[model samples]
Target chain A: MSVVRRSRWSYLSLQQAPLLLAFVMLGITVAAYVLFFDLRLHHLPTAFAWDSTISNALPLVFVAAGQGIVVLTRSLDLSVGGIMDLTNSLAATHMHSSVPSMLLWSLIVLAVGGATGLVNGLLVTVGRLQPIVVTIATMSILQGLAAWVLPQPGGNIPASYTNILANSNSPLGLVFIGVVAVFWLLLRRFRLGIALYAVGNDAEAANALGINVRRIRTSAFVLSGIMSAAAGLFLAAGSSGGDATGGDSYLLASFAAVVLGGVSFFGGRGSVIGVVCGAGVVTLLVSVLFYANVNSFYESFYQGIFLIGAVLLGMVVTSLAQRRARGSLRRSRRRW
Target chain B: MRNSLRGPRSSVLAIRLAVSALVGVLMTAGTIATASASSLAAGKDAHFTIALSNSYIGNTWRIEMENEFKSACKMAPIKTAVNCSIYNANNNVPAQRSQMSDLIASGVNAIVTDAASPTGLNSVVQEACARGILVVSFDNTVTAPCALKVNEDQYQMGYLWAKWLAQKLHGHGNVLMVTGVSGTYVNEQRDAGAQAVWKKYPGIHVVDQLNGQWDSEVAQRVVSAALPSLPKIQGIWCQGGTNGVLKAFQQAGRPLPFTAGEAENGFRQLMASGKVQGYSIGQAPYLSVVALGLAYEILSKHLSAAHFKTYNLPLAPVAVQNSNNVKGKTWFPSLGGDFFADVAQTGTGSTVAGLCLASAKSGTACPSGKLVFSFH
Candidate 1:
């Protein structure tokens, strides 16, 4: 047998180094929250501290997950905010209290998301334009459409829809997070999942291996678009209303969450699980700082410090793992 | 054995590190650039915790609003009786929601807020109200029925401005209406009020309407661009950025028109100097102080829930008669153009009376170190 297996630690470390930072950061923030605040676990049922955090963070989580997928394929979707705006406005304005109307509009809103994503993918792949440029242009267009649809921030999202989707009074929000995780897990076993990594790792190499690089890349965007649309629906539910420009802040926030979640911006090397934890870190830090009673002026300053520290820690750990893996390979070869 | 990871992996790592740093820096920089107010520790004698949950802090008006809040906290009655903290959400609804949730969890007795959206914070605000927390919103107020509100009648401000302009034009003139940002509750109400008044005067033709975005420079640029093709403007009805409109007219070599707009110092200065004739009224930044006062009164049992209805503040009287009239109170020569002249009010038994230039400018205590707060 010519094959020599490398050390298991080296293998795990190379693939999962960023997850370590994410989980550790999540743990620290959650612990700090409890320690600083009067977070009685027994009273959590009524306190709504945990429930509201989960509910409020859900939209950003969905947006980050979609951003993570596009990132895994070595591309960026600047139009995530724009797509979210349009779908959010659409859902808020159209959905009434009736189940039939809600259901019908839900499907329509999702289809609109898919259509917008397809346009972005097509423009990037067929037109051979820069992903950034194409997405930026589409983002502006979507924002305009959203503004035209709502014009102002006065649309009604049924109370029932909000309770079912993002209720701060119940643990229903955790189930949605689970759905995203399960979806990603199932996706990892699919052919498209493997191809996304390969394409992101090296597009030319992926092409040589008989993979349709353009199609794979475009599909990644389509999926991202659908996910972003879902994010819009979640946002409408959370706010129970709509604002045309509400999606503007989510653009930078999604990017921040994706990066913090250990998803490589260079593409192809992170899991949605880690991304969830990353989203948790982003959301919970606010509460942690609040309970710690850090002056609001220093809140952002502390957030910056923690973000930089986590990224640096992940990088350091990753390089150390790379060195260990290379060493193990040399040792195994010598033994052979 | 060949390396499975192709390409310059080290170079890739370097670039990845750089990109991550850039994202982090950008996020941090975006937040740090905004003005920030301090938090007051709950003194042992304090009976309640009142937090000011503001939405955005990018512009001067918001900055002044926050400063005025901080100044109010330092005064005699509020300083000893209530513990105050301020939080800015940078206009992100989700972030604001999170802050509100945390404030609720922290068990604050009252939240004085300027909401990010009129309707977005309704559910959370309702939750707060259900939990027996008093929620008072001013400026961009929330739509939740449970919440108490303190604000000037925005529609009335617009009506008064337009009525003044129409009268100046003798009910017949080419009027250019410079509006604030669209899609805002304030802008909508103000515009509607002005249009209502415009309808009554058939000869007051609103030749064009441009969005000033409520900023001085933006108003100047848009008005300047439209000046070339516009007919002689006999009157100007502006929601904000009034000084910018005058500068645009000045730069165009056109005679300054009779104008009615927000109470920026520069606009009042021009009026005092006899350079232009105009009427000004403002959504006073001190509304925050009033909201805080209302919240404090409710918490301290000085005012009952019966007094919990929307408190509509009267607009400040824009004193632009001469330099001496507005020198220290209405228009400060030492202050910049973007400064709101109506930061403090006196002689009105409102919460913001007795506030001084130092109080609005630097969050300092007045010489008297006393605050007069009336429920009415």
Candidate 2:
């Protein structure tokens, strides 16, 4: 009887590699964090509670999640932060007097975000430009437009809206959960999701298999844009209005979070769950550093160092696991 | 790829998806029930919103300005309290002008500004005033005539520096003057005041003048740079705060060079640290809050000139120092130990007696052995 088996190359090329690696990296990061900060089990609560420093990180989590999706599709959304900046102002300006009125304003702002993302999609796929340059241009344009919209970091997001989004955990968290679940289901079963994966894995092969590469990539960007906008609106819930400078710092953090999540810079292999875990670790690390009274300047440098160490640990762990499995296989085959 | 494009081509399916998404957004917004009406006094005839535009919260002085301004807002009449909000331009003048327009659109009744550049902001000043929005500028004066100008007399800042330095050195020394941004309002007056007073004291020579640009770090570098160039630099007359100067000198291993500075907490801290010669002129930006109070009074015509004068609100003066003469003058917190004692009265006797050349009037400045509370 002929035994059908996967090749070693196939195992190395599998998308699961990035996911497994991300999980291991996250574990190592959490462990190292516990050691560096001297954070004992007694310090942690049964459930994560939102506080001032943690709240500052919500937008970072949101944007990083969106960027994670984009990264999984072998692309990056450079305009996420800029799109955030634009939408924040749009929400602030249009959302006039009263909670209901402000929410309607946010919806309008979200639509604007969708539209902006669509523009980026058309530029990259239809125009056939590099994602980096395309987004760099849109980033500036969106930020400029934001400054034009709000001018100064003034205006109110209305207590009714911010009170719920920033302070209260009403249905927003549930909706966030819903978004993740829906995304997971789509990735697992939906045609569009499969096409997206196929394109990211190998665009030419996907094309030969009859996938419209451009369409998949464009749709990926659109999803990314929407997520970024949602994150912006969420952040506006915290500031309760618009700040033109508010979203800028998040751009770098999102990119860093994606990379730290064990997502390859080359892309095509990552999961939302991995990215979310990465965000949790980064957020926890930052807040712990703050509570530890670390100097403000060293924060970014420490995070970078942590990333380097996490990546190295991931590589070592994966290699060791591979060697162990190989030894086990040889032993079993020899016995046979 | 062509085959994939044909898979989802039903127009009806696309329409259903689009409609469903719209519904999703609508339902989500409805659930959130977010409020907007961005005004504190919505649909109220008596109350009004006022926008306060600052160039930047660039220093500790600006921070204190904010602290005091917020405190003063609480002191306002509850019913007609000014709905004041601040727009920090982050040191961008053009950005500030654009902010001014946003404020106008937001329906703020009055604006109190610290002009980023006195000349360039005229157009916005003109536009704001034309819209019947009262404009008052403080800290930095507007070249275009605004209704009220409330700022520390810049000349007084320099004159006091020179006087204090000359006295500290027994009326004879090579003095170093560290001024702020060269072409602006404050620097010009401060330089002129220093030069004018130092001309009378032939022995008090003006050896070197450097623009410290009102930044503590810059002040430090300039003072350090100029120290070696001076011939036995008997005194240092800093037109602005000298916390930076003291820090730089200390860090550079340079001993005390008889310094005078803007009366500020920085100077007080420097004095307390025993690093500075201990004299500064504090410009309370909270004066503008008072100016805002005055502007509202003027606009509502609630008080006449006499009644306004009777309000007894003026620039609250406090000399930054460690002398017994400057103790208990202002709200001296723990760190300000003996710093503000008689600080308000620093320029009182000198202003009347002409003893302190920094005072604008002869018999009204601080007496001998007392420092004058002058603005920079």
Candidate 3:
């Protein structure tokens, strides 16, 4: 057999290192659960034979990954939970009240998400406020108002539409992965994404390098808001019903998932691929805890510890990564 | 002998004391004779107008209770009633206080209110009593000199629930006890009752006692966070029906842990799940009817005030594993508006047979709303 020369496509495939790592980790965890815990992958709804753990993870992973993108740009949006709450309510309220209306509501939810992000961006870029401080306040205020939108927990989501979404064979999952691909491509293509990197790295220096630091930073929050709305729509469909307090927990989880995925909390460093894997890790850990017959009550605390721990680790890694990148840049210049 | 032995001043003091004592004895006998004669008369027209106050439409239980109260008292046979001005305190104590003051100002004959705070309302209760307006309380009880209370036997409810749970768990398990509002009287009585049942079963252990504060979101967070800390847990002891456990379990993609509380949709759904081993406790929302009916009985001179069991007029806390399995004994028969009529007309449930509304397949027939009407 003659050895053939490798093509450029081979190199491109190797570039998806973070995603491959996540998949390998997911497989190992799933295998471990099946082997050690004797858990049957049978919590799946009748229409699909897949396990409910996996089904539930679909929306979770999507939302966390969406949240990861914003964290990369050095801003946070606590209002995503609000977006989820509103989306869930709007979906239930508008469903087969008019089908077209439901689809319109979906877009409107995204618009609301983006609008929330826009507000955050304006605050950060124009008002110049710290992201966490701003987002945290917004989170509290929005939750108080959720009851005004819908006081009771019950609402009709046109069972047929809800059924289709809930029972579908992870079509949303596939679509989510596609959106991630397009987003990744667009970010890599645009001046905004590149300028975001430069600004996140060093705002003053990026401005010196002719990057529109303020505009790019503002755009980051706007994108985060839009993505959150999309995530909310998916989340609303998954939960079956809507309530004022529905999105309360997501506020913290989104931040945790971003930190865990390798996004730097202090601005520049980390990867989107890493954040996706981080979301997977969380999903895996919780699933394992459930399968291990852990007390059902301790899940929340465990999640909290896991999140706070991940954030601390992200901080350490970010410091190290920044140093390594700087060293590499210096060495490259010496060679030149 | 008195002239030789006693001073004139001493004689005068003794005479004054003797006359005062004589008047007091006669007044006391007259009051007793009046109550005795009324009970002897069998029936007199006893009527009262009630001013009702609601806290807020916060939970399903409260909403249903309000509906029950409305139906029970609206049709009460009291000869005269002004409209029961329903005021929502929005769960604020001050707001409730202001509403009570307003009701008092409106010159109502009786004001029946559920206080937001457990103790601060005693002043308002006293004020009503001082005005010769009768004071009847439900849900929230305040201590007053001659106050009559209409509520559930909370201690018994907690005891019964714990006893049943203990039996179901086979006398032993790692059961987490989640409580209702941290400091509410219901929580206190229910907890006392639960502890009483637990005393009998030395094998069962209460691993953790937490406050859910009657909130679903908070419950979910508290329960979710606490689940990992427990070891070898068999079931949960839910002192609330806030939908937190149900939602948390669903999110975890597992069957619900055991629970008990109000018979709300979440708890009801959880019970229907074959894996859930729990029972529910229902509060009689139509309790005002019971109080008012009792009040009518007391004022109309049908029920002997001496026969009243102190101020306790607690109705039964209905227990049900499932709506289909909810048996007759758990239903409150005194709820029928007719029961008030029967007690007014004949004095016993057996005598009120012709007056009761159609008893739904369940035996304890209730009036459209209330059974025992309170006077105040």
Candidate 4:
């Protein structure tokens, strides 16, 4: 058997299309800022802008990345929002000014998130339940639990927590984002990562190859839960409080980020890198619209239009590449 | 070719579903509309830019609240002195925070807000305060210590309503407590106040408590469901969706009990028609106008933020005895059941009074074409 080799450029243009889309989205965000504020490129990256934008978008970034993982495994976790709400409630209610309590409660929150994910994973794999049904049920249960933990939208998250996690005066939170990216990069090299892609590509094939499909799928969910918990902690920090229902908004937005990131819902494709940028795009678009002074009533209209446009653009690029590849293959066949 | 065709087709379907879902999410992310009227006379120089950053606009009360602010901006002094903008965040905390950041960046003189969360906006509100921008939050006020708040005491609203219900029952009755959305600051405060009043009247028993969610449809459903299980609810103390609760009683063919609830149009209509005897006190929609006026007062007058304290506006309780006040000014007969009746101040004061229904419905100026807001 002979193997065919492709150039780096070809692989990047075709396989890494999501990154390209992310770049386009980032471009639009920058253009929106410049056009609306009438500022030069040099004036774009202020510490204050970075601080506010990154801090606010940080929670979404983690959530979308977790969602990206779930999507990669061809599953949906509707309970991400509920998990976020529960963990946020837990962190806000228990985390004190002391470092030990903060650390201790943080672990507890993460553990709770993992436990919830385990439940989802077990139900999906062992119980043979649909992912959507399982997650929807878990979502409701988690939201109720969140309300039980913090009956009202009141919790004393210390100023030190806010400063350390998501300070408004500094863009230090970007370091945490970098850490998430690095974690994703490292995971890509592991056996579990390969198994995730293989199982998502084809469950039967993966099982035949002895890849432990159930375990891989379960691990993906566990990772997603941990990430969502991290997101909740960041949300609590950003808001400087705890709210039982606060995580409700992040649910749909995570799916939006996954789609915009060009992560195929069919599974076995895309990167969390693009998902992070997609989260940024989702967030930056709001600021861009605000600065552009678009009529408020039509804000959602524009957002929908933009999402469709981006998806269409991705499809067009992919189809063009596919046609080019087919043409080359036909020419080679004739020559042979 | 079949494989490729089917792949793209199914993927397209998935993408469409995702797109529509995203759109649905965006639709509720809120609108950022600039309501800066350009037809101002060119004589006065004291200009201030005040923005109303509201949390949700899905309900009638929120719409009326925003309309009042716009109407105020178009009237005499505010029209000339203030350039107003309105934004709705659809009850999303992050969305509101980003809007707050933008409002700060734009360097608006003041921001009048009905916050999504009491503490969710504390960080951004603090940033705004540090920037010397006056932040006045009304209705669902913020927990930011630096921001000025203008709101009717939610506790007082519940306390007064419960007190009225207790009196109507002669201090002995099975009253059903219909509370607002659970896990909310306002709902908790209001529920607590009502419970306090009930505790004093040992005979006044709260047999069942239902979560109305402050929506008419939900209130109707919950009240209807509970009516069967309940043993003769003698009095109804509804936090909101007053009309819906009454409609449930009517549908069930039960006698209309003495009620105390929000200033919904239908509730007032029932009282005016002698179909029900109750007290109506609303967490006024004009609270936005009040907050706007406060922001202007601090900005146009160059008053320091320290000069003002949390203005807990008095609740204007309209009793069932006052049928004359129900139809025209307090409650509009032409309006829908959900329309909040407490859109304008009924009495003469240095505050916003004499506002017409058009001001609440469509942001049109009153006949007076003048707005006055003075703290005395």
Best by TM-score: 4
Judged by lDDT relative to the true structure, which candidate is superior, 1 or 2?
1
- TM-score, every prediction: 0.91, 0.49, 0.45, 0.91
Docking class of 4: acceptable
Higher-lDDT candidate of 2 and 4 = 4
Chain A vs. native, model 4, TM-score: 0.93
Instruction: Pick out the ten consecutive residues of candidate 2 chain B with the lowest summed lDDT.
Output: B352-361
Candidate 3 lands at a TM-score of 0.45
Please give fnat for model 3.
0.00
Give lDDT tens digits, candidate 1, residues A1-336: 332445677788899988877787788677667765653232332348889999988988888888888899999999999998999899989999999999999899889988888999999999899999999999999999998999878798999999898788887899999999999999989999899999989999999999999999899888889988999999888878887777778888888787788888888888777888888888887776665555555656666677677677677768767876777777777777
Ranking 1 against 4 by TM-score, winner: 4
Q: What residue pairs clash in candidate 4, if any at all?
A: none
Q: Order of all candidates by TM-score, from best down to worst?
A: 4, 1, 2, 3
Candidate 3 local lDDT, B1-376, one digit each (tens) = 3432343345455446544543544344334433332111111343355666665556645555554444443343532333333445555432344345444544566666665544334444555666677666777664444456777687877777777778878888877787886435677788998888888889989998878876666778887887767665666666664357666666666656566555444555445545465676655444545555555566556675445533443223235675443222332333421111111111233211221323221223254432334332
Fraction of true contacts retained by every candidate, in order, equals: 0.45, 0.00, 0.00, 0.50
- lDDT of each model, Cα atoms only? 0.83, 0.60, 0.55, 0.81
Estimate candidate 1's RMSD in Å.
4.8
Identify the leading candidate in terms of DockQ: 4
- Model 3 Cα lDDT, one tens digit per residue, A144-257: 555556554435555445444443343445445556656766876688767766676788999899988777777777777776666555555554445454554555666655
Candidate 4 residues B280-364, lDDT tens each? Answer: 8888888888888778777766455576678877565333344555568777788889988877777645366656788899988
> Which wins on DockQ, candidate 2 or candidate 3?
2
At residue B333, candidate 4 shows an lDDT of: 83
Kindly give the number of clashing pairs for every candidate.
Answer: 0, 38, 29, 0
True contacts kept of 4: 0.50
